[model samples]
Target: MSGFLPYGRQTIDASDVEAVVEALQSDYLTTGPTVARFEEAFAQFVGVRYAVAVANGTAALHTAYAALGIGPGDEVIVPAMTFAATANAACYLGAKPVFADVECDTLLLDHNVLDPLVTERTKAIVAVDYAGQPCAYPALRAFADRHGLALVADACHALGGSLNGRRVGSLADLSTFSLHPVKPMTTGEGGVITTDDPDLAERMRVFRNHGITTDHRQREQAGTWHYDMVGLGFNYRLSDLQCALGLSQLARLPVWVERRRELAARYIGLLAGLPDVRPLEVRPGVGHGWHLMVVRLIGACPPGFRDVVLAGLRARGIGANVHYKPVHLHAYYREHLGTHPGLVPVSEDAFARILTLPLFPAMGDDDVDRIVGALEEVLEDVR
Candidate 1:
């Protein structure tokens, strides 16, 4: 039998280990030089002017929203199909997250639906790079500009992706990335926000360091023991150790993304002849980062058939999993936001059918074949 396959995993090597060890022996550990180095390198990679390191992806979102001055009575439009953290971050700052429906094919936020959701209270449009595919940024950008709303890219799933030669991080007013074990890269657990706006970057830097005017490094460099608290903030600082690993991992990202795309294409080709299963459509001009290799059951498949297929795959050690339940359908959102079953019909419909297959840089072609073989068996069993 083949070994168990996880939906995703980190691709660590000896170099990554050495980098962390070197940082451990360095003079500064937390939020120090290595963190700044990682931030700078990441900014260059994304073609952004500034990048601010943070504790996690959710912190990146919260800090970005806060930097945009999102506050009480403000509303931030979020795609209904993303991870809850996308919406939860806005709520953390006392701003409402208005859930928007996604396109049926890509599960990306549909720009067509934004017109009815916009209101005077809308402060920003947080577009998620769902499954590592870049959203239709041109359309979304035009809409945000017309409505006087700030555009934010929740690009945690799309770190290395590009659209028409423009990188994902440079596609919005502010862009966020997650360097989790399962993502395109790993810092163990870290996040970074990228932007061209200097003011926004500085705000995020201060916000991550307990809202203090200067961090320990700055104070020490100036040979002063003074610091000032400008506002309330969380200790959302990414450690130097994490950043060290991040630098090593970041160096490997381009190669890794290429590998991911190759694997995704292999899956697409292997599954092409399968009945009632189809991979999400990739939009033209998109250089998909392929964070998740998602497929949906179609036609004659029953409403709950996705869960059954997921169970079958897992039972066979395939490690298949669902990408998400729509944010509005989650119990917390249902109660708190008064969201109901049919609130976002397309999202709810997609949620019932979609499942994420295992895909990572370290995975081999045979692994892809094994997964597809298992899926084929699962479908055959149901029939």
Candidate 2:
């Protein structure tokens, strides 16, 4: 506990290390059996028919959008509160990302706010499960259906989360997940796309491998070197070494998510004493994966107060951070997309006050207490 605690981190055990070592010792480092095994296990875990592993989360989003046939002039609706990658992926495919406001309490994509953003050119809606609570998928799904638009879930923060009984990966037309070290599970640097449609799955598989009809493994199995590049794609393949680690880590996901929830509950109880600091609301029937322990500074706390709190906590070795600044507010989006302040007021307001406190599966209840205690002291000092 000597070092500064991070807001989120990977929790790897000896088994994870062993898995990677075994993968390294194997004949295939990439495009091999281990990758297929991880994909199958992940799909089954999330109640989806297919999962295609890729280089990373952004690649997953890019592949998902491409699979849905989103292209130039296509507009994709996405919440402003999410990571820039959510919107940037759409940009990668020459699709415009139309920013939608998030719900105040949850920082989740507000389906109600999406109506005004939809246009004739709207090709899809990307629902971001901000801070690991699944978005209002039922509403979003229904909305997408009415508009004949594809629904994609930017579920990088919500690998193990669910709404009702349906898992995050199974909640949309195509769901993308990050397997970054800080995510629910780690593959060092990797991502996967989940879908019930076989066609979409195949598209993503091809998309990750330079749009080639056959991979080296397939060519080797068939005893032929012939292949065809059907479409332009990126070399976004996830290696077998990472997949081996992911498979090991995926096995412990349920337990890790449970621990995260337990830590979140502990944070809630401890922060009750801090009247100005309020935890984000968890919607009913949602099983949050709690990738971030985000809280809002409500009551009399004004804009810039969150930064003060962040500074104070860092001085005390509590690694408090902010989840995001709204993507639309970023410089690139403002210049290119004509986005400006007041575009999504709710998200703008939340961005100013929200703070992400340390929360990881390896953290103890005492860690939650320490973080809350530090937050309390920071608030008191600011006053």
Candidate 3:
């Protein structure tokens, strides 16, 4: 047996621990200035006017959907090749999630297929930044504007990713980020919603904290013990302790993202001549976060080839995995959306060939070499 290399892992330092420790020592652990500070800092980092911290990525998505007033009878277009949360958020709002095919190269939503999916019922588009590469935002934005749809960037895998020099969280009407432990940065488990719209920001803030009109800080500062419940909301608030960890992790995000990019470049160079595997095409204008370095196994590879390669990598201490099955292929979606196998051809085809190789900021040259070596060996065996 050898040391297991996970597909993704958190990189925490002494400073991160110290920040959490300081928060633990403070009187206000859950509701405090740390959360506010984190929100402000995150908003500034992403060039957004406001940010609302929430419990997790799903909560962030749900809150964003709710804030946008998406409900039953409305349709939200989502890429099929993303995590289920992207589509599930629409379901949470009792809104239908219209599945769209992805581009063959980047695996992000294909704007070409979007127009056909738009209807009078379409209220929004939840564009995912698959594998940390930002989607074609300008095209998507134009499409959304043409259809009068709200564009939400499900940027959970793309915190540090950007397009046309603008950051991912600032590119859409509203953007959501996940700070899960395995992400580029971590707050143990947390998320944030960013937007420039003041009313949307307020709606998100209200929805994240039990629908309360006033937060604890405001109540405490004003010495008012009573509060009003403005609307139906959830207990989706992120604690100050988590926010402390987030602030510290955020400070190191630029360095971490750069390292991930370097690792991705190395993977690209090492895998270039390998005939059986192809890296996803990254367009020039985007700054990819490289959260997961996914590759498509090409040629006469069978449908089970990805699983075989994944198993081989695991046996060699390299934790290779798949990014996702098309959301429409999921049982729940098939049952609810009445989606069948052949609905999104590109997304389904990509799903069978795609494999997520181990990638993280802490990975070194040797790690890359080991993964490359294992992949080469696996491909040779398959051939």
Candidate 4:
């Protein structure tokens, strides 16, 4: 309570510490039984047949794109509101990323705006569950079916969410997750990809391990040291130590998600008093995981009002931040992909007003109250 409250952070417990210590004490630290154990647990949690763990989320994205055969000349439509990694992964696979606009209210990819960007060369749709809210998957799935394009989910922000009783990982052909410290859970640094197709699962597994057909443990057990590099790949393996942490964190995911939801509701209730603050519109039947608590400023708030609020909150030991600046507006994308400001109008406008407040399981009622009080004071000064 005395220190700065960050916008997002991992909540580690004694059990998490014990699990990591146990992994360190084990005979194997990396590419061992623990990795498979964590993957199995995660797959079950996500209601998927297979889950491949990797070094990090970006690696998971790259592996998913590579496994799906997305390469040069192929286009993958993604929302401009998401982290750059969602599109950068396509670029890594030599594919062209066609940036798409997000809906003004939800800050999620707008298929109405996205469908026009599709072309004969479009190979996939990388639907990101921005801010932990599941995308419009039912519609997106039908569109992918019509176009014969792969549907992948950048679901790092939505590990515990669902849409119409279907879990996030099972919603798409291939769904990717992150284990960064600030996410719903942490493994120090790791990621996982989920898919029901065995072929895609195998391809992603090989893609994470330098295209090697079999892991070292498999060769060692066979007593025959023969392995082949079947396809192009990289060393994206997550260590047993990290997997141990992930498994421990997974056990607490449900409670953590519920806590986030409660905190989000409280923020909504509190922000309602401030007429100019507006929470994102959550569509019906969508199970939001609440990775971030974002609110848009309304009612003729000054042009740089969000910036003033951020500076004011920072000065008061509250670490508020913006979820994103539209990906296409970034310098690299503008220079390399010929993207411009007006490419996605709604997202660009949202970026200017959006402000992310702290929301994590570790925070209690007092924390929320403090953040709200700080924000109210900042908003008053801005007004």
Candidate 5:
């Protein structure tokens, strides 16, 4: 009650600290064995054959786009509701991003809208797992296969999330994850690209580190410093120190996900009868990571109701916030793509009413109660 409860936060413990400390004390801090080890562990955990650690999620997306041969004149279909990186990756390749509206309830790309969008230039579909719930991969896969297009899952918010017992990363041709402090796990601003395709994985590996064919560790094992610059690439490698932290964090991922699920259930039960507020729908067969507990304000709410609720939560020492505005509504997209307000009605509608409340592993029943109490007060005052 005294301190500000954040919308999301990293739950670091002694093991995480020790991992960082050990890395700091070790010989290699940057581009070292730890990064590879972390990648291997992550790949195994996600049921993927390979994983490439990078500087951040945006870099992961860019690398994946480049690796899959998406470039000038190509088009990638992306959900309008996701983070900009899902579409910006295509821009990085000098390709255009074709925006598709999301499902009304799940806020994920509607596969029904996708096929019509695919043209002669369409190269891939970047399906985002919005709010930690996996997209309908089976349907997406079928569509991608019919068009001979790649399927990339921008799973930055869904590391521990899955569908029908199949992990998120393994479901797509390539999957990317973010390790920012507020995500399901943290590596203090790091990311990893997972894939079953060895060639694509190798491409991402080289691309993440200045297009170098062999990394420092590989050179050391071969007793030579010589390496080849395979192609044009960016300096997007994750440090060993970050990977060390990630490895420790990965060990706690299961419990963290479970706790998040519990918290989400508590919110559902608490707000069940509330008329003006509704939780986002989670489709059956998918395990939501609950990275953000988003609730939508319903009919007849004041125009400034969201802001009022946010201010009231802050006043009560809670850190509630909105996830995002529709990506196509941003200035750059409007100017470049000529995207307008009605382009993605579902995403635009969700943006107007959605609020992300505090939901982290560190929260307890008291925290949950505090948030609910504050929300109730704000709703009544605004109504």
Candidate 6:
């Protein structure tokens, strides 16, 4: 049998190895020149004026929230279908997370669903880029402008995605991305926040390093040790080593994103004829980065049909996985926020039927064929 096909993974070549090795050989490993270079390259790639590298995507969100002054009693509207990080970051700043419904097809925040959820306490709107496609940014911008709410994007799944000719990083006031192995790029474990606002960028830089005014390198160069804790923060800085890997990965991102799009098209075409499944749809004028090729099982899933299909696929060495369960469905949210079953009907429905297939840059046609074949077999058996 062939090896297990992961839902997603990183692709590292010799060039990536060389970049990490070179960083290891350098004098500064933790916070070095490489971090700055990576940040600059990312900013340029995303068409943003400033990018702040953080330890992880969650940190980027937390920093962004803090920079926006999101605090006690403030409310941030978050789509209920995304990773917990989307709402958790708001909670980190003692802000309340108001749940929003996503569109049934794309699993993205619905513009039509925003009004009922907005109130005077609404401080921001965090539009998630679900399954790598950019959210409705123009509508979101209008909504934010009308309410004077801070607009941010939890774009962890959309690194190279674009909306209406604008890269995701520049689409919101503060956009965040993840560099986990499964994401579009990997830095082992890292994240970045991109924005055109200089003050927000500077605040994030300080917040990532324990709210210090100057980094260690700056203090060392001045031949003095003078720094102050202007605000409460954490050690959320990305290491220079990881930044080196990220930089190398960033160089190949354009091609990788294109390949992902191609693979996604192939999946869509192959799955189009399947009556039991429906692939997530991409909107017009938006470029999907194809983070995860998710499909929903249609109709009555026959009790454990979903689980049985997942088990059958795994038995055949296919790592079919569930992209997510509704954020509010978790025990903590249920207990703390009084989150109940029908908070967002569409999201809850999706959580029950969604299944993510393997899709990555390194995958080949044979791999796609293998997954499709395995899924077909599983579906036939379950049905």
Q: Is candidate 5 or candidate 6 better by lDDT?
A: 6
lDDT of 6: 0.92
Which 10 consecutive positions of candidate 1 have the poorest summed lDDT?
298-307
> Which scores greater on TM-score, model 5 or model 6?
6
Give the alpha carbon lDDT tens digit for every residue of 51-81 in model 2: 9999999999999999999999999998899
TM-score of each: 0.99, 0.99, 0.98, 0.98, 0.97, 0.98
Provide the lowest-lDDT 10-residue window in model 2: 298-307
Which residue pairs show backbone clashes in model 2?
none
lDDT of each: 0.93, 0.92, 0.92, 0.91, 0.90, 0.92
Between candidates 3 and 5, name the one with more favorable TM-score: 3
Order of all candidates by lDDT, from best down to worst?
1, 2, 3, 6, 4, 5
Give the alpha carbon lDDT tens digit for every residue of 92-168 in model 1.
Answer: 99899999999999999999999999999999999999999999999999999999999999999999999999998
Those runs of model 4 whose alpha carbons end farther than 4 Å from true positions after fitting are: 301-303
- Tens-digit lDDT track for model 6 on 100-165? 999999999998989989988999999999999999999999999998999999999999999988
Candidate 3 pairs with clashing backbones: none
As a TM-score, model 4 comes out at 0.98
Query: Which is superior by lDDT, 2 or 4?
Result: 2
The 10-residue segment of model 3 with minimum total lDDT is 297-306
Candidate 1, 255: how far from true, in Å? Answer: 0.7
Flag regions of model 2 displaced more than 4 Å.
none
Task: Kindly list the per-residue Cα lDDT of model 4 for residues 1-383, writing each as its tens digit.
Answer: 66999999998999999999999999889888999999999999999999999999999999999999999988999989999999999999888999888889898888787667889999999998988999999889898998899999999999999998888899999999999988989898999999999999999999999999898888888998999998889999999999999999999999999999999998888888888789999988988999999989887656787898889999999989998988999999999999998988998889889999999998998898899888889888878
